[model samples]
Target: MASTSSFDIVSDFDRQEMVNTVDQALREIKSRYDLKDTKSTLELQENAILVNTDSEFALEAIHTILRTKAAKRNLSQKIFDYGKVESASGSRLRQEITLKQGISQDLAKKISKLVRDEFKKVQASIQGDVVRVSSKSKDDLQNVMQRLKQEDFPLALQFTNYR
Candidate 1:
């Protein structure tokens, strides 16, 4: 019997990188001419980011800066699931941007189905927020990874624990 090869697919981001990006964004907000007097604020919570600004224009500027910083840190913008802007006290606007750290059950099922349908020799099983793909041939596993990369998914994925 041939030994099976497998890998796990996961969607996660580095917390330190996120912290660095937020710090950079804060610095830019303080230094930028247009933003210096706006008193805009950005706070990183356990699983979300709180952005508060006085106006819609400032909010947009903050978002642009945040995106730029995140990209510079090699972080995917897809992780940011922004909520609706709400009015706060003193006419301020607040927006909560949730961080996506895991794959949804629906997406995991879709991925499993795609793998089972496309590669007869490969088997994919959902394990919570991750999908484990196993096959007797390493080449088949590589092919599965390539196919998954080619397909556009709303969230960013990473492959790990290959054995």
Candidate 2:
């Protein structure tokens, strides 16, 4: 009998890094002459972020700052689902940015199917939001990881819990 090696594919981000990203962006907004005194604000929610500002230009600046900070922190740009700008009181504009957190069932199914079709030595199973891949050969597992990385997925993928 042979033992199998396995790993889990998950889509996640570091919450503390996100908090730091937002804090850094807020500091930049306060110091930047164009954004300063524009009353720009960034608020992080449980699963989203809220931005409020006086003008469209300021809003754009905030977005740039946010993106730059997030990138520097190694967060995927795809995580942000930007909402349309809405009117707020006293010539203010507001926008909501949603955070992408998990893999959908459809995507997990697609990944499992792909692995099953392409790799005879590998077995993939969908366990909740994660896809678990196992193989007797560690080389086969590495090949599976490489193949998955090549395919474009909407959310970021992190392989964990290797055993």
lDDT of 1 at 68: 96
Point to the candidate with the largest lDDT: 1
lDDT of 2 by residue, 113-157 (tens): 999999998999998988999999999999999988898888889
Query: Per-residue error at 102 for model 2, in Å?
Result: 0.9
Q: How many clashes would you count in candidate 2?
A: 0
Model 1 regions more than 4 Å off: none
lDDT of 1 by residue, 24-73 (tens): 99999999999998899999999999999999999999999999999999
Q: Pull out the clashing pairs in model 1.
A: none
Q: Candidate 1: lDDT over CA atoms? A: 0.96
